[model samples]
Target: MQCHQTSFTLSTAGRGPLRLTARVAECVRDSGIHTGLCHVFCQHTSASLLITENADPAVLRDLEGHLTRAVPDGDPRYTHDQEGPDDMSAHIRSILTGSGLTVPIRQGRLALGTWQGLFLWEHRAQGHARTLVVTCFGTAAS
Candidate 1:
């Protein structure tokens, strides 16, 4: 059994999904783990990760729109406004979405559906550099 870990940083523009499928594939390919699992974790409370359709731009737009409506910022019920109106809202969105994603690896590549793609969902209204830690573990071909 072999285990490899790596990380990447994303500078988000705020409030949307940024596809990172290719980047992760590169890591998996370089890890030399022919068959394994790829676990990507977001190291932030206001951001999240997801594996959703990457073929259509509208899909991402609609998903973002739905999340915004479901957890709109500046809500009167939220009291954790230390970071701004979007602080609590961001945390809520992150919880609703996810903080990490796990994908299967085969032949040193991600075994994802054709339309499925990894994405970093930024919940804040302002941009921030988010870091993601990726861990790959499995047996290497001899």
Candidate 2:
């Protein structure tokens, strides 16, 4: 058994999904771990990770729109607005989504669905730098 870990930072343009499939794959390849698991984690409370469709932009837009409707900013019921209207909402969005995800590694690469892609979902209204920690564990490739 083998384990490897790495971390990287990404700047989000705010309130959208950023593709991370290729970057994560690089980490997996570097780890030399085959037939294992790759876990990706977001360090921020307001941002989350997702594995969704990467083929069409409309799917992302629609998901974001639905989240906006479900977790609208400045709902008036939230009191943790220390960072402005979007602060609490961002936290809510993160909770609704998640903070990390795990994918399988096969043949020293991510064994994801053909259309699946890893994404960093920024729930804030302003751009900010986000850090991600990726850990890969399994048998080292021969």
Candidate 3:
């Protein structure tokens, strides 16, 4: 078995999901692990990771809309707004989603569905830099 890990920084434009499938796939390819699990983790509390549809932009919009309705910023109900009204809301959104993801890898590639895409969801109102760590572990190619 072999293990490979790497980290990269991404700049988010604001509060939204940014596609990461290709970037993560690059890591998988670099790892040279033919079969096993790929673990992706975001080292932040105000952002998250998820697998969602890549075919339609409307789906992403709807997801953002849902999150906006479910966790509105400046709701006057949160107290941890040191970084602005979106502070606590961002944290909530991250918790609601997640900070890590695990995907299967086969034949030295991600085994994602045809329309499946990996994304990093930024929950803040302002743009910020986020870091992601990807670890690929399993058998090495012969």
Candidate 4:
């Protein structure tokens, strides 16, 4: 069995989902893991990972809208607002979602559905650089 790990950095514009399937595929291609499980993790507490539709922009927009409504910034009831209104809310959103995802790798490519894509969900209001770690574990083809 072989294990390969790589990290990529993405600069998010704001509160939204950033598609990263292509980047992750490139990493998997470079890793030379033909068949295995690829674990993608976001090394942040305010952001999360998700696998959703990539064929349409409306799907992402709807998800963002729903999250916004579910966790509004200021409610006057949050006491952990020392970092700003979005601080605690961002953490809460991350908790509600997730921080990592594992996808199958086949033929040196991610085994995602036709419309499925990996995304980094940025819950914060400001633009920032986010890091994602991609780890591939499997047996190399002979």
The segments of candidate 4 whose C-alpha lies over 4 angstroms from its true place after superposition are: none
| Top candidate (lDDT) | 3
Q: Estimate every model's Cα lDDT from 0 to 1.
A: 0.94, 0.96, 0.97, 0.92
Q: Which residue pairs show collisions in model 4? A: none
1 or 4, greater by lDDT: 1
| Inter-residue clash pairs, candidate 2 | none
Candidate 1 ranges beyond 4 A from true positions: none
Candidate 2 residue spans exceeding 4 A from truth: none
lDDT sort, best first: 3, 2, 1, 4
Residue lDDT tens for model 2, 1-142: 9999999999989899999999999999999898899999999999999999999999999999999999999999999999999999999999999999999999999999999999999999998999999999999867
**Candidate 2 or 1, higher lDDT:** 2
TM-score of every candidate relative to the true structure: 0.98, 0.99, 0.99, 0.97
- lDDT of predicted model 3: 0.97
Better of 2 and 4 by TM-score: 2
lDDT of 4 by residue, 98-117 (tens): 99999999988999999899
Better of 3 and 4 by TM-score: 3
Candidate 1 per-residue lDDT, tens place, 1-142, comes to 9999999898999889988999999999989999989999999999999999989999999998998899999999999999999999999999999998999999889999989999999999999999999999998977
